[model samples]
Target: MADIESATAQKLLKAFMQFRKTGWHDKKISGHNPSEFKVLATIQQGANEKDYEMKLSEISQRLQVTPPTVTQIINNLEKDGLVERTVDPEDRRAVKIKLTPTGMEATAKARIRFTETFTGLIDYLGEEESEQFADLLTKVQHYFSELNR
Candidate 1:
C-alpha cells in the first residue's frame, strides 16, 4: 500500500510539472504571462466586488506573494500602461492599484479566453465530471490552506 501510494504521488507530481512546463493555462492569453494575467484578474475582480481600486497589500494577499514581489509586478504593469498606482486617500502610506483602459481591455480578453477554455473542459469532461473535479480541487485547496495554518 505504501509503495502504491508513493508511486501515485510521484506520478501526480510529474504530471503537474509537465503541465506547468507546457503552460497550458497561459497559452491562450496573449500579451502577458500567466502570473501577470493572474494579477490583472485579481485586481479586476476586486474592483468589481468593491471599489474601482485595490490596495497593494490586498493584491499581495490575493496573489499569495510577498509585498515586494507584488510591487515589482505592479511597477512593470504600470510601465506597460496596463495599471496605475495612486496613494490611498484614507491611508496616505498605502497605495491603491487600478487598471488602466488598456488593462481593462486585456483583462476582458483574458477572461473571454478563460471562459472558452472552461467551456471546452466542460465539453470534454461532461458537466457531472467537471463538477466533481471542481469539488475535488476545492477540497485540495482547503486542505493545503489548513496545512499552512
Candidate 2:
C-alpha cells in the first residue's frame, strides 16, 4: 500500500492524467466522433467479411457497448443520412444495419483522416519507438482487462 504513493506511482498517474487531457479521444474524425467512426468502421468491416448487413447485436458485441448505446449511435448516423436499417430477410424479428452511399463516402474520408493522424504520430515517434509504444499500450490494456476480471 505504501508503494502506491511512491514517486514512480505518482509520476505514472500524472502522466496518464496528462495523456487523457490531450483530447485525442475526443477529437472528431470527419464530422463524427471516434466512437461513431468506430461503429461505421465495424459495419464496413463486417460487410467486407460477410457481404451482408450487420445486426445491432453484432455491432454491440464488437464495440463492447450496450445495445441502447449502439441504437443511439445508429439513430444519429441514420439522421445524418449515413446509415440505414432494414428488416433481416431471413429473420423478420431482427434488424440489420448497412451504410448508406453517403455513409460510405464519409467513412472513406474519415478513414483517410484517421490513418493520416496515426501516421503523423508514428513519424513523430519513429519506427522502433512506435513499435515499442504499441506493445506497451497492448500490455497495459491486457493488464487492465485482466484486473477488471
The candidate that achieves the highest lDDT relative to the unseen native structure: 2
Q: Model 2: per-residue lDDT, tens digit, 11-96?
A: 98999999999999999999899889999999999999996589999999999999999999999999999999999889998889
lDDT of each: 0.91, 0.94
Which pairs in model 2 have colliding backbones? Answer: none
* Candidate 1, run of 10 with poorest lDDT: 23-32
Sliding window of 10 residues with minimal summed lDDT for model 2: 1-10
lDDT of 1 by residue, 33-142 (tens): 77888899999999999999999999999889999999988888999999999998889999999999999999999888878888999999999999999998899889
Task: Name the lDDT of candidate 1.
Answer: 0.91
With candidate 1 superimposed using the best TM-score fit, by how many Å does residue 2's alpha carbon deviate from the native?
4.5
Candidate 2 whole-model C-alpha lDDT, 0 to 1: 0.94
